[model samples]
Target: MIRLMFLLPILLCLGWYYFLRVNGVPLKQGKRGFIYILAFSTLVLGFFVLMMHLTNPG
Candidate 1:
């Protein structure tokens, strides 16, 4: 379940980028890079959230 949660964000981001590319939307390189970073951050945040809850499991 934890791995699935992390993968969800990444897959969604990839689908979004693919949609944009297919539509021929010319996104700036910086913006594209930021999106990738944000997607990865989403995955990291999921991990942190899991850890936080586990640490305080009450």
Candidate 2:
């Protein structure tokens, strides 16, 4: 779970990077859209951590 959790962000970043590059949204992701992404990042990371800890309580 830890292994996959880490990879997911990397994949999401790559996908976002490519999407921005193709759309010319700049590397910063624009100020207005940042908040939405920040929230999403928090949710995704939080969920991953929670799930991992819950499933592997060793």
What shift in Å separates residue 58 of candidate 1 from its native position after superposition?
6.0
Q: How well is each residue in 1-58 modelled by candidate 1, as lDDT tens digits?
A: 5546666666666776787688787666436755776768777887788888999958
Q: Which regions in candidate 2 have their CA more than 4 angstroms from the true location?
A: 31-45, 48-58
RMSD of candidate 1 to the truth, in angstroms, is: 4.1
Candidate 2 per-residue lDDT, tens place, 4-56, comes to 65665566667767788888898764544545655677788898778878999
Which lDDT value does model 1 have at 35?
73
Residue-level lDDT for 50 in candidate 2: 88
Report the CA-based lDDT of candidate 1 relative to the real structure. Answer: 0.70
